[model samples]
Target chain A: MALTRDGPRSLGEAATGGTLRLAGYLLLGVMLMMFDHRNGWLPRLRGAAAMLVQPAWRLAATPGRLVEDARRQLASAAYLRRENARLRDNLLLANVRIARMQALVRQNRQLKRLLDAVQSLQMQGQLARVMDIDLDPFRRRMVINRGARQGVHVGQPVVDAHGVMGQVTEVLPDTAVVLLVTDPSSALPVVDARSGVRTLAYGAGRGDLLDLPDLPVTADVRVGDELLSSGLGGRFPAGFPVGRITALKPDASGSYLRAVARPLAHLDRSDHVLLLRDLAEPFGPPAPAPAAGPPAALLGPAAAGSAAHPAPALRHGAGA
Target chain B: MMRLDGQRVLFYLSLALAVLLLLLPLPAALRPLRPWWPALVLVYWVLEAPGRVGLATAFLTGLAADLLAGTLLGDQALRLTVVVFLALRFRARLRFFPMTQQALALLLLLANDALLRWLIRVVSGVPLPPPLAWAAPLAGAALWPFVFLLLDALRARLRLREP
Candidate 1:
């Protein structure tokens, strides 16, 4: 009976077809998986496919927009009036801050000129719009509207108004994915602005908090210490405000303290972000090079004065 | 009997529309409860025309779904193929069952899909919430009767013949 059933009866033939189809599907699945994992050809294919899907996405988003409009219409007139007044007050506060920032910029320019800066590094960046958030909650990834076509490249530092946000990880033709600093995978070298104590800050995956590891238990770090990019890691330019120490707790296991810092950037609120270009290099050991200049010429007066100011010690004490 | 060519085209078009619906930007609050529209449509087609809608077709549709959702490839394909295969294998018995019983079966099928998805996510180092994720199956089951009635009416109106 088994042999007869297995023989090429009409039903057996159909079953064989089913088996063949499954085999084909399995083969296709393996090929697709390999291509996607390798990411060489798949990204280009995905970009092309994205263009095809764009129209469908636009149509689907229409309903969401309509719903938003309807809700706004249903809102009470009194609520709109209150919102308007609140916006006006916020605008006034923002105007004051802008004026102060402009003055500070002018002062910094004059000071730099007086210091006789030689070959100053000037980086310019473009503003990009946030396209989508990661579907998986565990991944702190976001897609931006700008992509390779818009000069966005992988590893470019992205920032919001306040401070460093993250870096671009994947670049497509029309979109790029940014891994936010709040992601557990992200790490940045930061320094205390006042004291110049350099430390590495790692994201704890909490929305706005970063953790500084390996601080001495007796370290003079305190709450409210302003943290800025150390520029030790060439990924980010020096002096960009990163975060501020918000809490400190001594660990019982060792002589180290666990410090939590809140990011200066408003990760949830910012709609536009700047992708900084023209950073020297990323955090890596310096390459060996031939000495071409005198020690005094290499270590200029500005460098000597900066080293003389025990800013790191002062910052540690103030933070503590 | 309904003409197979026109019906096939209509089926594919509806499948496309269902996929688009799945891609729509739903409100955060409602997103969790968003119906697995593509899965439901796939199941309907598989059950109604098993000859045309087979494991391979199910897998391809699932692949499309994975691509649209930005999930790991083959994840949805595996689930969808399993679901369609089971439905096709039991179509004779399933078609005889009452709508409520059929709904219960659908609930079980959807639960299986969700369970597989959750396991895959866990294996991929993602955190999984508790059993509340199974709520979609219950919702899908409740919706089964209305979906069946609507699709059945359309089939009857079009004089569709079972494959």
Candidate 2:
């Protein structure tokens, strides 16, 4: 640069320094990419940076929300009445199911006590509104309006009313990023509800399908079978309805079976989600929380706040 | 060494608007057509106010973009640096080209940048982009004329020119 300042120089000569700087920036970019791929290395820094742009995320959601709001207000009275009746009937049906579930839970707890087994789970749910939908088309992810300030943290299980949706992969001051179960890199462990055969459900990458790989060809899974979370992944609570097996196919090697299931969760349109505050299963490493059976009143604020979920602390070690 | 002038304010404001445009939410059907706003703005600056807009400004803008877009850190930084460098290297000829010719050059440049983005996504082991993803460069190119005229109005109003 100093030499070029006094003498006539070719463009290449003048740009040598610039070329070197460009190379340096490119190399740095690759390094950052690698680090980010490795579970978003340096999440704290990313979280802090994410705070500055939280408002932008909010602003982006406003137009869509406004449109929905306007449509809701302009809805016909007959449509509203019909929707209200349908919802009321659905709520009544759900309440009955909940009552039956409570009775069954009591019976199960009594049986566990008689067998000297671990205590039952009691998880709570927090609702958050989705702020952005699939910010990037290539990846299955969405941003939510809840964040660290709302006790929304990484590794929380996010579900909609229908079933499992995804897990929180990142959190900012007022927004969070949830990695959908349909993302190519995501995997969920599920069991055939009838046959009790456990298999891993991997994201099929097109955004709405999950493929069960590595099941032996003779595996008992069949079309129309119900799949439920097996609680083996530590991130998801057990017994949640995952998806239904849609088809079964034999792999190229002919030794194992591959199954595809359409996820039950409304992955494309679910705007309201609940974050389950459940801890890890009992089989996980010993947790910092006290032994089970303590009253909610006796537990500390963090534990008590999350006590509604069966055992959330056990998995914090694994997922966090 | 930017002076506190209307041109300088307009430069930063235009860049901010570009950033907002990039983050603006669009319906799924319209997403593929979202122009690469930052690159278009940078191209305009490098061509019109070469002394003020360069590698450093591009780098910081890229970082903010990466952070906001939730993409890998430095990815946008690297892209901006490359765009600025290419623009600077060819500024002499690009300045004299016809409007249509300039827009075509931007199309090719942005298309290559899109390819770079695909490579980064592949390296990160994410899902491959849909075929419709290629439309971004085309959309960006088509939008160049309007962007050029708009930013030009601001620069010309302030008498912004090459140093």
Residue-wise C-alpha lDDT for candidate 1, range A1-320, written one tens digit per residue:
21232223243444556666666776676566556655555445556688754455455556755776798999999999999999999999999998998898778778879998532346888998765333333346666778889898888999987999989987777777787777676898988887777888988764447989878776678899999988776878877889999988887787888889998987766668999988844445656543323343355676556554345434544655
- What number of backbone clashes does candidate 1 have, counting pairs of residues 3 or more apart or in separate chains? 6
Q: Which pairs clash inside model 1?
A: A195-A311, A195-A312, A195-A315, A221-A320, A222-A319, A222-A320
* Model 2 per-residue lDDT tens digits across residues B1-163: 4446667788898888787677666765676667878899988987776766768888888877777776677778888888888987887789899989998999889988989888877776667776788888888889998999988786666664423
Measured against the true two-chain complex, the DockQ scores of the candidates, in the order shown, are 0.23, 0.36
Each candidate structure's count of clashing pairs = 6, 13
TM-score of each: 0.69, 0.82
Candidate 2 lDDT score relative to the true structure: 0.79
Best candidate, TM-score-wise? 2
Off by over 4 Å in 1: A1-20, A38-41, A69-81, A110-140, A157-165, A182-320, B1-6, B27-35, B122-150, B153-163
lDDT of each: 0.71, 0.79
lDDT of 2 by residue, A114-185 (tens): 999784577899999987533655667888889998999899999998889989998888888898888887
Which parts of model 2 have CA positions greater than 4 angstroms off? A1-17, A34-39, A283-320, B1-4, B29-34, B153-163
